[model samples]
Target: MWNPHAYLAFADERGRPYFDLLSRVGADAPRRVADLGCGPGNLTATLAQRWPQARIEALDSSPEMVLAARDRGIDANVGDVGDWVPKPDTDVVISNATLHWVPDHPRLLIRWAEQLPARSWIAMQVPGNFDAPSHRTVGELARRDRWAERLRDFRFRESPVKGPLEYADLLADAGCAVDAWETTYVHVLTGEDPVLNWIAGTALRPVRSRLTRAEWEEFRTELIPLLDTAYPRRKDGMTFFPFRRIFVVAQVN
Candidate 1:
């Protein structure tokens, strides 16, 4: 139940890392490009613009997201990234801000690297802010006595994403030339409870999906103050959110 509109709330801020990752791809004219977990396809459309002659295909696990992507005239389908296999001629594989959601994504990366044609490119970006105050607050709140039992099985506290070096090493070991780096973007956001709104589109989805409507409302109510305190609005009425993300671009040998 991914809210495409909510996910696109800070499209400009969310898009920067993808463009940065793409800039390092160095693929001038790929024959085919696959955007795994391609969200609403707005960014996937850019791949088409960059290589108009190439076939741009996208896949997202969320049907809601795929529908929104299809609205943009993208060849977007509903499929899980873990189940996706690159075509033999697949020239570029882009997994922007999506790998962290897939368990054991390191293996997936290695498999893609092994399966792609020689000299093919794989570009991926994942959030690296699991230890940040925003996520810390969410973990803290989820552990409180009032909600602890209900969310006992919730694993949002544990980060599945690895560091840049780890990805670089893994891909390098898989016979790919890897370029990996990290960036912390300070995004100045406005509007009410912007951080909550931001995570509602992503990190909060699991909680929301598991809880009833009333319980979800109650949970959000409890979370609002915590997020507000963690990311207090400045005198200028803007909240500054520092988001860290890791990027890896590998050229398969």
Candidate 2:
């Protein structure tokens, strides 16, 4: 139900933060790599370009996204991240802005740490803005308003996330050499209802899926007023929506 095309519009906005998260790979040369949740494969293609000698495979659960990625000539496939495991002797596993979707990710991280080769890297970034107002507004409106009668269970989708320390500790416990940090990214999104537009492509999918088209429109309409107030329009007619994201890089030691 997540409109992958609409999400692509904000991909450029998310690029810088995700790239910064990946810098931990440093100058280490990797022979092969995999990109989890490689939406449209734009960034996945960069992995191929950076390590032209490396075998790069991009995977996502969305068939639409997989097709888009394949059309770009990247090796793309549809797969569930929760069920994905590292290939033996794989050199690098790079996941940008995708880890938050999988529930109980600390355990997943520990599992991946155990599977990846010694000296190889596991790098990931996850949106950490679940407690922010942009998200809070959605959850509040979903439960407090008239729509609450029917969509009572439509709550904030739980993400498997922890503070930077939590991730570092998990990796350290697993005998990984770990690096972790958080970043606040102010994504400058164009047009009205920028925050709504951003979530429409991602988090709002579950809510959208539960409602009729008219009900969805009504929900969107009701939600926009709240977001506009929460995230005021800039002088340039764009909205600068701040997003906090967690980054972790662990190398099997």
Candidate 3:
């Protein structure tokens, strides 16, 4: 039950990394482009604009998100990234802010590298801020006695995302020319409980899905103050949140 509107709440901030990753792709006139985890198709529309001749296809596991993408005139389908296989003509594959959710994405990258056509491009970005205060606070609360048993199987703190070097090495070993980097963007956000509102779109989805409506509300009530404390509003009514992300762009052999 993904909420497309909630996910797009901070679209500007969330879309920056995707643009940064795309700039490094260096794909010219790709015949086919695929956007894995293309939420709401807003950013995926940019891909079409960049290469109008290329066929743009997108996939997301959430039906709601896929519906939203289709409503935006994107060729989107409900599918999981882990099971997706690139077609022979696919020249560009972009997975932005999505791989963190796939635990075995390293293997998938290597497989894609092997399967893609020669000179094809694969670009991806994942959040590297799982250890930051926003996530740490959630993990601490989920581990408490009151919530521990229910959240025992959920992963709140640990991130499946690898470091930049790790991804570079893996892709390089798979016969790709890899460019990997990390960026920490300090976003100045305004409004009450802005941090909470931000996570509600992403990091908090699993927690919310696992808890009852009343339980989710209670958890949110407890989380609001902690997030506020961690990301306090300054005199100008702004909250400075430093988010870290890892980017990798590989040209497959």
Candidate 4:
């Protein structure tokens, strides 16, 4: 359901969380690296640059994404991150902005932490924005009037992304040195309906994929104005979108 072009439209902003997650990963000179949910492979290419000699690999669920990434000289395969199991030689594993879609991903992390070899690391980041108005409005509107029944089968907005403490304890209990924290980035966006444009690339994807062209446009009509009120344009005509994300980096102890 991911359109590579649409997802990459706000590439810089979407890439921020990936870079932030990578910045905290302390693994060095890894023998092998695996990037889970490596969408479009733009950020995964950086890992290749950082460790040219390492056996670097990437996986994503979307064939289109894998194809796009391969075009960028990144070796990516279409595979669900949920079914991924690190090889014994994998020294560094990373998943950014993609785990929330997998049910019980925290448990998945714990299992990986328990099984990884010494000196190995697992780092992940997921958007912690279910409670934000951008998301609330979308869920709210979907449950009203003629849309509720239509959208009944498309519900998945409230993801199971956990808090900093939950992740901290999860990895620590699994015997890894953990660093977990949250960051709310207030991105100043320009252009018309900037907030809508931002989520259109991400949070709005499920709804967009399920709705017809006419239905999507109608939904957009309701969504954009609500987003305008939720994230009012500043005097300089830029919309400030506050995005919160949670990051955890775990190195096997």
Single out the weakest 10-residue window by summed lDDT for candidate 4.
153-162
Ranking by lDDT: 3, 1, 4, 2
Q: Which candidate has the top score in lDDT?
A: 3
TM-score of model number 2: 0.94
What digit string (tens of lDDT, one per residue) describes model 3 on residues 12-51? 9999999999998888899999999999999999998889
lDDT of 2 by residue, 1-253 (tens): 4456787887777677767877788535687798998988878888867788888878898899888889889889999988998888578888887777777777888888888888888898888888888888888888875778767777574444788998898899999888999988787778767789888888788788888999999989999999999999978797888888988988888
In the range 1-253, model 1's lDDT, one tens digit per residue, is 9899999998999999999999999888899999999999889999988999998889999999999999999989999899999987799999999999899999999999989999999999999999999889988988999888888887788888999999999999999999999999999999999999999999888778878899899999999999999999999999999999999999998
- Count of backbone collisions within predicted model 3: 0
Q: Which stretches of candidate 4 lie over 4 Å from their true place?
A: 154-157
195 in model 1: Cα distance from truth in Å? 0.9
- Candidate number that wins on TM-score, 2 or 4: 4
For model 2 the local lDDT of residue 154 reads 73
lDDT of prediction 2: 0.83
Off by over 4 Å in 1: none
Put down candidate 4 lDDT per residue, 80-158, tens digits, no spaces: 8888988889999999988898988988998898778897989899988898998888998888886887788655566
Question: Alpha-carbon error at 30 in model 3, in Å?
Answer: 0.5
Q: What TM-score do all the candidates reach, one by one?
A: 0.98, 0.94, 0.99, 0.96
In order, the Cα lDDT scores of the candidates are 0.93, 0.83, 0.94, 0.87
Instruction: For residue 29, give model 1's deviation from the true position in Å.
Output: 1.2
